[model samples]
Target: MNVYLAEFIGVAMLIFFGCGVLAGNSLKTSGSYGAGNVAINIAWGCTVAMVIFCLGDISGAHINPAITIMNAVMGTFEWSLVPGYILAQIAGGAFGGVLVYLQFIDHWEKTDDPHAKLTIFATAPAIRNNVANFFSEYIVTFGLAFCILGMGTNVFLEGLQPLATGCLIFLVGTSFGGVTGAALNPARDLGPRLAHFFLPIAGKGTSDFKYAWIPIVAPIMGATTSGLVHNALYKGIVDYRLFAMVGLTVVTFIAIKLASEDNKEAIKNKQALNQIA
Candidate 1:
């Protein structure tokens, strides 16, 4: 299969399953309602794992710009191919988002909450603060990219590593994902956000373009930062586990600090309001 074709197929699967979870959850009377955070996280993680299994050999099954960019940075992929891959991935993701929307169109019209409709198509923060939302996406993507770098470097662990990487994403979503809905992939966010903008949906929130840059910029920054860190630590000796642990820990620490700061800010704001009232 052609690389672009593989990217299309992989990204289609990603958005289908990824947004499918939201449709399942947000649509009233659906079987997945109240299925809660664990389901969404596991579904996304498994979506990545499944896509990689189906298309890894064909196109490295990036289905994500961060992954493609990181691969290019590591010299695993040619720079010229990056744009095509990213375009295909976005197209596929948008296609998948449209499919999910169509599948749940009736439920969407049946509902009236704009936020609920938005959730069906794209991510939104639990609390709407730009700084917190940006940092959340930044940290999640950073951890994800760091893990990808560590796992992708191991020659003997090719097939199994994708599954492990998927689990890392799963954990990121479950533990720290609540703040910003864990949009760790740029294609995953932008493609679907675009779909929501174009698709006929009732009461969908604004596409939030001002905040849209977070997922794209942060993931690339996180991924590149990971690559730099890996190169710095690369001693011509391959120790996959050690590298993974160290890289994951560093990213996780950053994410936790961001989250903690956000919490502190929230508390301070509440206290200030109390004092005034």
Candidate 2:
């Protein structure tokens, strides 16, 4: 299969299964009541693992712009192909979100809660705090990218890397998902946000545009930082023994201090702009 085609299919499958869990939980008539955060997180991890297995040979199964960017930064993927991969991923994700909406249109109509409807389509904080939410996404994406970098380096573990990636995602979700719903993928968040904008779901809230940029910017930063860290470690600029300890310590510190501060400032600016408007 062509690489672009594989990306399309892989991303579609990701959204289908990942968003399927959201629909299962939120939609009243779906018969999947009580399926909560743990279920959604596991579904996301498994979806990623399955997609990678299905399309790894054909496309490396990035299915995410951040992953593609990281690969390019790490010299694994050609820069020329990044646009196509990102486009395919975004399209597939949007399509999958639409499919989920179609599957639960009746339930969406029945649910009068705007936040609940939007939650099914996009990520929101369990508690509405900019600092914690941004830190949550930053840490999750940083951990995920670090794991990807490690997997990319170990040739002997290449075949098992997807499973490792899946496990990292599971850990991140299980550990820190409560804050921001673990939207570690920009395409995953924005595609469904777009779906919520276009789909005829009543009472759907604003796409939370105020906080939307965090997932996109933070994940890219995390992925790029991970790539740079990996290169440093591989080149012996940093001791491999200290890689995890130093790398994670740096990532966590940056996430908590820099990203969270930036997010708070952005929120303040957005609120100021809204007030002026």
**lDDT tens digits, residue span 83-144, model 1:** 99999988998999899988887777767778777776677788876566766776677677
Output the number of the TM-score-best candidate.
2
C-alpha TM-scores of all predictions:
0.81, 0.82
Residues 1-277 of candidate 2 have per-residue lDDT tens digits of: 8999899888878887888898888876778966987888888888898888889989988888888887786677799999999888888888888898887777776666788778776788888765666667766787788777776667755567777778777788888877787888888888878888888887786878777777776676667666667777676545453355457646755666776678779999999999999
Q: How far is candidate 1 from the true structure (C-alpha RMSD, Å)?
A: 6.1
Candidate 2 residues lying further than 4 Å off, grouped into runs, are 155-160, 237-277
Clashing residue pairs for model 1? none
Best by lDDT: 1
Number of clashes recorded per candidate: 0, 0
